[model samples]
Target: MSDIEIIKAKRAGFCFGVKRAVNITFKAAKKGKGVFTLGPLIHNPQVIEKLCKEGVCPTENTEDRNIQTLIIRTHGIPLELYQTFLKKDFKVIDATCPFVKKAQQYAKLLCDEGYQVIILGDEKHPEVKSLMSYAGKDAIILDSNQELQKIKNKKRVGVVVQTTQPTNLLQEFIGKLVSRVSELKVFNTICNSTALRLKETKEIARRVDLMIVAGGKNSANTTQLATLCNASSVKTYHIETSSEIKKEWIKDVARVGITAGASTPEWIISEIESRIRDIGGNGDNGYPHESGRN
Candidate 1:
């Protein structure tokens, strides 16, 4: 064994949606006005700290009329909350990801078309909740296939998903749903960026001795990446920063693959790669060189 090697996913880190949200938030922060987000913009503490330095803060309650500017996060908020901000006459800067917007739009359309909209994702997730608002009170949130048995009104069913949900889980949910429904329409609202990252991570995990999945601890997409890597039955570690990587975890490993969540920045990924190289003698593990690897 020569050293650790990183097999980074081509589509990993700051997808178009996340990048747009971050850029909008940073630009608003630069205005140096009283700007507040409904929640942390993107879940990365480092990025949130940087925003805080620029006068962007997060508030849990939009009911407080003192705030001048209310910025929606990437995951978005329920429609009712957005309406509340409008009623309060706050300057609303919508930084919601376009992909997330599509999901919400699909949910609303399904409801308008008289189908019972079913969201395949965590019920508590802000994105799913936001979709529910558009779907009306009749919308159902399904987190797992087991919950499919409880669904009623199988004649007209429409399905959408949280942007960060695993593709396999979404597909499985859809598969189980079709069996129970006479009419099923699926929008496939899972973000393309997330699907691509998951596919790449699985492929890399299969060929590496160990894998490092880096992102914010609370980020749903990041957690999903770690879950996918672990499902490959490889030695996988999920860490937010380079400091969290343990030398013992990869001490006996030859090739190490590294991947980051969609919310992660390139600098964070580079930092982890540098730390891994410091532990091993070299970075490629003496494997045959492939053009444009990593």
Candidate 2:
């Protein structure tokens, strides 16, 4: 009998915002003949595929005349894009996450108040781009690891973060900026779900011999979990689905842990857990170390 044990993070998979967006899209699909999302509703490809089967599809641009209904992505679209879509004949459904919407509002507020806005996140991420649009042309985007460059003569500075940023990263950056600007206004825009998932994943990584991080490779939060696991010096594999799990990775491992990103679905996590059992896990014992949180 295999002695290997498997544990799953209680906080893993399908954060509130993702669930809300998916549910709204599915509901919309049931009510209409032609429903389209401005982009993939979330970062998970498997979820997107399922939506496609339901007659819900993603359109990169709003140029199609055949588009009858348009749903905003969870990450949200730029202010101008959203405004332009409203002028079209198609019905518009906004499924943007409330947290992301809050960040956008704060960015716009800061800009209008004459504070030079600084956003903390990957510059290329859709969420960050949306925040930048609200912050106006002079706003700056900074990565967590990017060095803080000295500002020339800005007096008041305002900071807003992507909803998925690490809490510690925001704190660290804010500390550095306080001394540089005469007035510093900071909004802790990081979502509580993202913070808790990272904390739980790190704890699981420290206790397990190997970690299986499940989510789309393109998902920012999913990749962040893998990066955190690797930094903890544990063997980690970031997979989109159960099929990506390799037999060799679990060989000789006494304990394996499973964690998923905000966009990951419960079914994907369950499938991965079952795959681990078929490979080398000793069954469901210690499988779900429930923390009473989803």
Candidate 3:
């Protein structure tokens, strides 16, 4: 049997917010309600597909009039759409993560206080878009320190961040804005789960020769995890499922580290582990050790 050791990151599965959102959606589906989500509940496709089969339809927009029950994604939605849903009298259930909701509230607080609100994240991201809406249409979305040049000598600036954004980026952005803006209010709204995942994955990357990050390809957090690992000294591969684990990638790899995005389900992690064991060129007992977490 080939000798292989696998290390699984403890934080490598669904975070609290995603678990809460999935539970809420499944519960609604079991009640036989016409359950619907404004967008995919979470980034993981497998989870979304499973929910779709359970009759939780994902709508591109809020135009559907017959939707009996609507669930807001964990990423939250625009304030305007939320009001529209209320006006239409649709039974709305908000699944927005507490951290995301806090950011939204912070944005609104800044706007009401007449501060120049600046969102530190990708403008196209739904979370940023929603947060910006709360801040006001005039609020600026700043993606980088370079973008800060666009700010025209504001008196007071209030800043909020996307929940999934890297904490270092936020600190750096604030550092630059500190000198430019006379009065600055910086709110660090990154989720705890996200911070933990990054820390754990980086630790694992240092210990293992090969690192495999598991989750949906389009998932921003997942992509970030993979990017972090890839930039490190270890060889890292980002895969959505076990089937993508190539024999060549694992060839001659004695130690492998596995980390999944927050949205990944437990079953997917297990499948990836099992596949790694099989692809390590040993069916019997290649997996000598697995530590860190489930």
Among all candidates shown, the one with the greatest TM-score: 3
The worst-scoring run of ten residues by lDDT in candidate 3 lies at 285-294
Residues 1-294 of candidate 3 have per-residue lDDT tens digits of: 344689999999899988999999999999876789888888889999999999998997667776889999888988988888887756889999888999999999989988888999898988898998899756999888889888864788889988887788988888888988789988888877888899999999999989999999989889999999988878988888898988878876778999999899999999988888777733334434445421
lDDT of 2 at 155: 90
Off by over 4 Å in 3: 1-3, 279-294
Cα displacement (Å) at residue 258, model 2? 0.4
How does residue 22 of candidate 3 score in lDDT? 91
Backbone atom clashes (below 3 Å) for every candidate: 0, 0, 0
* RMSD to true structure for each model, in Å: 4.5, 5.2, 3.9
lDDT of 3 at 8: 99
How would you encode candidate 1's per-residue C-alpha lDDT over 238-258 as one tens digit per residue? 888898976677665668888
Q: Give the Cα lDDT of each candidate.
A: 0.83, 0.87, 0.86
Compute each candidate's TM-score over C-alphas.
Answer: 0.85, 0.88, 0.89
Candidate 2 regions with alpha-carbon error over 4 angstroms: 1-4, 144-153, 282-294
| lDDT per residue (tens digit) for residues 1-294 in model 2 | 345688899999999888999999999999987899987888899999999999999998778887899999889889988899899999999989999999999999999998888999988888899899999777888885345673543698889999988788888888777877899899889989988998999999999999999999988789999999999999999999999987778766779999999999999999988888777643333243234421
